[model samples]
Target: MEKLEEQIAHLTRAVDDLSDIVARQEGEIVTLNRRVHMLMQREGEREASSGGAVVLGDEKPPHY
Candidate 1:
């Protein structure tokens, strides 16, 4: 029936729209993951260079 066909067409469009949204999210997730990985690497390097020093006090250093 025509009504059934119309419903099918609407559902198809909705599915396509959702697919596009999912693809965009996948790309964004990949970019965010890469940024997080780079940030972690930089943090690791910083910790290593700093020799993992622990500040005993809540006060800021005099350099601030």
Candidate 2:
């Protein structure tokens, strides 16, 4: 019975630790999603101003 109690205690602690990790991840995901949304908005504005041409800086010129 004592062994079973000890196992239960350990499992409870593990569950609590995992719950904290999940909570932290959820917060981080929210922050990252917000940042992505803002970036997309900015890109959309830039594209509109650039006459719908998507200019990727990595592209080489015709001379290349």
| lDDT per residue (tens digit) for residues 1-64 in model 1 | 9999999999999999999999999999999999999999997998789887764565588899
TM-score per candidate: 0.83, 0.84
Query: Where's the lowest-lDDT run of ten residues in candidate 2?
Result: 52-61
Q: Which stretches of candidate 2 lie over 4 Å from their true place?
A: 54-64
lDDT of 1: 0.92
C-alpha lDDT score of every prediction, in listed order: 0.92, 0.94
- Alpha-carbon RMSD to native, per candidate: 4.3, 1.8
lDDT of 2 at 41: 100
Residue-level lDDT tens digits of model 2 in 1-64: 9999999999999999999999999999999999999999998998899997758776688798
With candidate 2 superimposed using the best TM-score fit, by how many Å does residue 29's alpha carbon deviate from the native? Answer: 0.4
Report the alpha-carbon TM-score of model 2 versus the true structure: 0.84
